[model samples]
Target: MKNQNIKVRKHYLLKMAFLALPFTFAACDTEDMLNPVPETSISDKNAFDTPERIIGQVNGLYDAMKDGQYYGGRIVVYNEIRGEEWINRLTNGVTGLQTWQQNVQSGTNEVQNLWGAAYAAINRINVFLQGLEDNKAKIDPTLYTQYQAEAKFLRAVAYHSLVTLYAKPYNADNGASPGLPLRLQAETTTANNDLARSTVAKVYEQILKDLNDAEAGLPLTYGSAVLNTTRAHKNTAIAMKTRVYLHMGNYAKVVSEAQKIVSGTTSFTAPTGVAHALQADVALPFTNYTTTESVFSMPMSDLDAPGTQNQLGYYFNAAPVGNGEYYLNAAGIVNDAQWPATDARKVNFIVTASGNKYLKKFSKPSPFTDYVPVIRYSEVLLNYAEAAARTNDMPKAIALVSAVRKRSDAAYVFPATSFATQQALVDAILKERRIELLGEGFRAMDITRTLQTFPEKTGSGLNAPAVAPSSTDYVWPMPNSELATNKAL
Candidate 1:
């Protein structure tokens, strides 16, 4: 057994001495971006050194991800609000709802928060990589390799998120769009602060490179199987690759990569020797600890609770258990004829009180310490199904999609004749993604990739004079803060 001390070890990076130099930091403390690390006191002497601390730095990277700004909530909440699967009564000062209804300009808080939070995490990962490289001679080769792989995986995740929110979808003009500043090296000097945006193609190229290394480097297991799902492992990198390939519209790669985690030639069975599988009771872990379906989940210790103000539960759950600022879009799911009323998701994943239908997927009472799902097995299945359908593997696509559907409810299972063409199968797979992964921050990307129109929300107490995927409002404007700081953007 792995030492419990190592498996459960947690570190708070923001509270500790961060990359003591701005050269390794993504952005220096400026008037606009968060100066999360007080650079004034940071120095080489205070930065992470000893080999044992490398693991701590790795854990610190998780702390950066645990921020409600990213996995803690906003990422998922923002993605859902932008899609038709949710509704909000926005006049009650719900900026979350307004993110979709009103075209938030470059100056909006959403742009700033999402951009700032993501880079902050990226910078931390960069520092971890730099530190790991420097101390490689002192650390065990096995452990050092794991640390390096996990750090790169986290960095890739951050960049993938950055590009997804700031630039158009990868297929958009084949990634000709401007992407976020791709800072591969650790930033330490002011000269590197005002970097320019890279082409979306270049950003994705780097993301894939990192994930590829992670896939090759991360160990098959992290000793503790439960923690394996929370930390970077071989499957973590593979699952994330599936997501990246899906976003890039690389159907064949998506199918091939997903197959490594899921048993193929057999449709939906979890692969032998792989830990991931569809949870028998899908809702159990959302309120508890890590589970098999989770490839990588954000583990937030009690002391490091994803702060109350921006937590996902606050946005989706009701007052007694949450903020209840939003509710499930009845027309999208509850009343949609395509979705069976008796599905396990509705019976266990949602809650209704005083005539209000709310999604309780992220609900974990006030402190909301529930582990956040980053990439899960079912999603990989959906990705594989979509890719397989598009690549002419009809039986595989139909079986893959049906596996997920039947897991929730046999009644919703697809009929053999349900899809007659590749497009029909793809459409059904996409719908399954919507049903299975709602409120997990996928709707926006799916909409952008598929060029689906915004749902035109009703009762949001907000107005949109205009909305379109091709419009500037579709993706976040480089936040005014970044624009003012990085002139090249």
Candidate 2:
């Protein structure tokens, strides 16, 4: 076990001109928070002279979020492997992610980094919002409002990621469990770090508020397809809201929010200015960055690769190109007869060799640089379908699920009389979610929210011999390093 102090400072701000430059400023790198400050630290007040300068700060927010520890890889892979969807291939020099498979203590690097990186990004979003509010007079009203909304979206995203891991599921006794330390303010040196943890209810309230604000202020499109996918947009926040509400067991709200994105159509077509819809080819989203389906994909390029060890390929692609750190859960999806054999996803996504199944969805070559999908329209439709089932809208549920299901396996679309009961339709929706979002990072959260027990309790590498239905092991403890310093916890 190791300790990491997530010291959040504003020195890492890139100049507005640097945003136009090359790879140098593409990825955000974090220095040890406890380390000596760089002499180049900019005063928060002066960091942005022009409104354009703030864009650099906003861009850097995504980079911090794209921290291989979070959206980059571990954040997605850790959650997926924890459930039965994948068997962690631990023999290939297992260190970083093996701890996740083992379900290590709070001090483990995987959990620590996930905590540290999210807070670091959250802190940056705070300062960015604070700076914008303080300097609103100097900036264009339109740009100022947009960035404010964007910062809140990023902040809500960071907090949501943090709480999902560090605390119980949002519906845990209806969010009565202790959530994260609500660090909403921009921390200066004088501000006390000893803030108390908020209840899951309060944390969710804040998350919804941020998302609602973000949705109201964001536009349908930004500068480019790349920028539109990377940054927060109206649909991005709406897509996120569906996930949040779905987790909270607010099925009506989930259907309500998701409908804003999917509209009345069962399939999600990119509306007017939006370039998002389900990619006709299942693998196109990961391989070609943005597709009609990408609601919010954290952007990665040659200029901004997620780096060597932290790259997603190191964990997923195994055949001839990758180290093959993890493989698909055979009983779950790899060879399941229920999953149509001719399913395009099965043919294109499930990669197998020597009886082991590795997923190719994250298959960017070494120096892995696959643009991580944060929230795709596919998930939005699934969310809508799940909510529809819960609300007893049988036709909508069956139709929505079938619409998404047919994209990957046209031969397997449900018949008109299929799914006789709500439970049956919900079951189909749950299976679709796990298969459709395999490497895209929605498995463990789905498992927890649905009150299902983790299936990989017994495994070779890092799994506990016997995990029961009520084990606290599913909930990550607050990191020891932070507790030592923050008395309020």
TM-score of each: 0.89, 0.89
**Which consecutive 10 residues in model 1 have the weakest lDDT in total?**
8-17
User: In order, how many clashes per candidate?
Assistant: 9, 4
**Please, what are the lDDT tens digits per residue for candidate 2 over residues 1-489?**
123333322221222112212122323334433453344232354456565676777677778788777787778877776777666666443335544454668667677667777877777777677777887887878888788898899889888888887888877699998999998877544245678999998999999999999988887788677777888888889889999999899999998776666755556564545756787898788777766677788777788887666766777789566777777665676666568778888888777777788888877777777888888888888998999999999988988888888898877856444498888889888888877888777877887888777775343454533344378787777876566556787
Model 1, 296: alpha-carbon shift in Å? 1.0
Q: How many backbone clashes does candidate 1 have?
A: 9
lDDT of candidate 1 over 329-402, digit per residue (tens): 76676566677778888787788866778888876787877677788888988898899998999989888888
Residue ranges of candidate 2 with Cα displaced over 4 Å = 1-42, 91-102, 264-266, 270-275, 413-418, 457-466
